[model samples]
Target: MLDLHTHVVPAGIPFAASLAADDPRWARLERGTTTGDVLVAGKVFRTVPRVAWDLHHRRESVEAEGGTGQLLSAMPELLASWAPARQGLDFARAFNDWLADELPGHDGFFTGLGVVPLADPEAAAAELGQIAAAGLSGVELPANPPTAPLHAPEWSGFLDEAERLGLLVFLHAVGSPAAQWFPQPMAANGVLFPNSIGEGVAGLIATGALARRPRLRILASHGGGSLPAQLARLDFLRDITPPLQELMPEPATVSARRVWFDPLLFDTGLLSHLVTTVGADRIVLGTDYPFMPVDPVAVLDDPALPAGLADAVRHTNPGALIATLRSHVQQRS
Candidate 1:
């Protein structure tokens, strides 16, 4: 089994200390003397786990779970894309360096998806080349960054650079002000943050981004969020609305199928809908490992999926993505 969506916090990096005194968007980690949990911006964020830093522990855990490989990206809070361009660049470089050091000599059990400082396009593009050179397959970009959404005009350069480098751009949702309008904490945090991926997809289709960057590889996490559920509505609006028709000449589903999605949706019913609408070949197995604790293998093996589709989601679809990842890992090995 291959788990595509796992995260790691680099050991010995004082992520919060890198920020200036006036920087308030992110909190520095304050390790507890007695407790395993680390406080971030005065709130208890998470208990630091050895698997988050220890390769031996992580490898043993994955082996026990029958996982052959795992892709490592930075934990979302560490992204700090909202910070100043200079700071963002520094953090990104440090993170990517740590990834390069940890990943290059290791066996094929681990592959890394590096990070970019989206606030600075030139720096981001430059770093993309460095990351590719470091033997990472791709970069994990925030779907709704503090500066702009994934498909906004400002992001075209970054997207172009990614395509040029043949990097798989994984769009993971990070919290934003717009997504917080739901008012209720649970609703905003749980429902809004995850489904914001839908907004990113809609923006991509409406802005003709997918059409423009045909070679860009985008893999959406959380079963493409609500895009699978909203496919028919987008198609209907595109057909009837003159403005949308011009922007989206083809059906939304058609453009959507061109991208890949992780089957991390909690609901099997929603996963079924995604498989049917997005095509099984475009669906890949992702567990959101250590965060969601859902088994990708069990989700794929559900009796609800067609037999062929079960195999495709479990292996073939992910193999398409992994094939690209393997090139980087093997190059370094």
Candidate 2:
């Protein structure tokens, strides 16, 4: 089965602090007596996992997990859009170079979804052209990039560039520093943070970004993070709120269908509900492999699912999402 929402690290890419030794936003990887943690400005940001860079073992693990193939993206933590433009560009180039190196040897099992310098959208668009030519399907992006929201007017150029380049945008989210603003002892510093994915999707819908780029393929991670549930409410708000009406002016539900969601909700009922809301054709199989504690294969194998729904999620839908890249990949093999 095809797995879309998996992550990987380049073999020799350094910690952000090493790349931008002078940038305060960059984090250094600190090795401790028992564990490793990333320190940003000399404070512990988060602990990391070995599988983040353990390529061969990750390959074997995915194989054992029964995936025929996976789309590899740099973990969102490494997306480092807050870095200065030059440093960000350097990191993006290194990430793309590593993927280019890795893809030639592993024909069917690996597909590269490279990173971009989102801090500079013009540069990002230019690099996306190179990534497309390199046979990668698309790029992975943080839903809440440092520069702006996904649908902000400043992002229109980049969105148009991506659409023009025919690259699918995989929108994933990591914890945001803004999580601190929620309240003391908030779960947001951990679990609730990534719900930014939902915020990004809803923001895009509310602002009519999907309508502007009807053909722009976006695969939202973390089961599109509460977005499906918020669809009706967003639609209602659009009608009653004059400001939202001016922005969206159309039903939010119509725009929601433009996105593809991965079934990483970690619940059978949630997955079934998402499938029903978005339709099976718009759902893809995603494991968040070797990271999140969910079983994509088990979900697909659930006997309670509608007939052919599992197979469609596991294979058919993904194939359609990456149709051009799949054809390119088949030609290479």
Candidate 3:
């Protein structure tokens, strides 16, 4: 199995220490050691360790699960929270450099998903360029900006460049800040645990960003964040909106077909629904390993899953996606 959603923390990237100093958002919050201790949507939930960074520790987990390849992403929300564009860009470059050195030469067991300075698009474009040059498989961006929606005009250029370079754009939920912005009670009631994930998908659909970058491959994490449920509503909106009609022949067509969904979902029913809604070919296996006790095979083995779809989710989908970006790097080289 090729685990698509594994996370890694590079050796040089300060873990808790950096969060305490540089990241005010998480620093102020009361953090817990285990997944249950961490608060999301005003409820305490356990937080899983990011295992991909620790090669030795993860080897057993990977081997135990019959995993042959692991795609590593930077610790969640690491680059997204940097306030300044320059600082975010610098942090992204440093993180990618560390990952490049650490991931390669591991018997081809590991590949990296580069992080971009989404706080600054120019910086993001530059980082994307560097990632393409380095021949990394893809780049990761927060599903929603730590502070804003990613489909805003500021992010368009970065998406454009990613499309031009043939980089796979992976977006994962980093939680929402509505609770932080409003009073605790109001925030608690109004904020959804994984609502940001849905917002990120909606933002992309509304902004016509996907339409603008047709060739760019986008992977949305957490079952595309409630997208499967709202397909009809988005489709109705598309019929009424001129911009969407002009950009896409069908309203939710771009999102339904163009964007891919990952299988990090803990609920078997949800995973099955996503496969049925998005089509198995568009779904890929994402364990969100280390942070979650995910058994890739168990997810694949779910009785509801189609026969051959398991192999595609586990290996073929990710391999094909990675091959596209790697080909670009080879051509450049």
Q: Which candidate leads in TM-score? A: 1
- List runs of model 1 lying over 4 Å from the truth: 15-36, 178-187, 293-297, 328-333
lDDT of 3 by residue, 155-250 (tens): 777878888888777787765545666566435523453565667876777667776677978888777767766777778877787876775554
TM-score of each: 0.89, 0.84, 0.81
lDDT of 2: 0.75
Residue range 52-167, candidate 2, lDDT tens digits: 56556567766786677788887676788777777888888877878877777775577878788878777877787778777777889888888888888877877787777667
Clashes of 3: 6
Any runs in candidate 2 off by more than 4 Å, and if so which? 15-20, 23-51, 54-56, 178-186, 189-194, 239-250, 293-304, 328-333
Clashing residue pairs in candidate 2 are none
Summing lDDT over every window of 10 consecutive residues in candidate 2, give the lowest-scoring window: 9-18
Q: How much is 107 displaced in model 3, in angstroms?
A: 2.8
- Alpha-carbon RMSD to native, per candidate: 2.9, 3.7, 4.9
Cα deviation at 71, candidate 3, in Å, is 0.8
Ranking by TM-score: 1, 2, 3
lDDT of 1 by residue, 1-333 (tens): 667778887665444464634465553444443324544566766766667766667888889977788888887777776678888887788888888788755587888899888787767778888888888889998877767777877778888988887888888866667555776655766776567788887678777788778888898877778786677888888888989888876788888987888887767788888877878788877776666544544666678777787667666777778887676446644
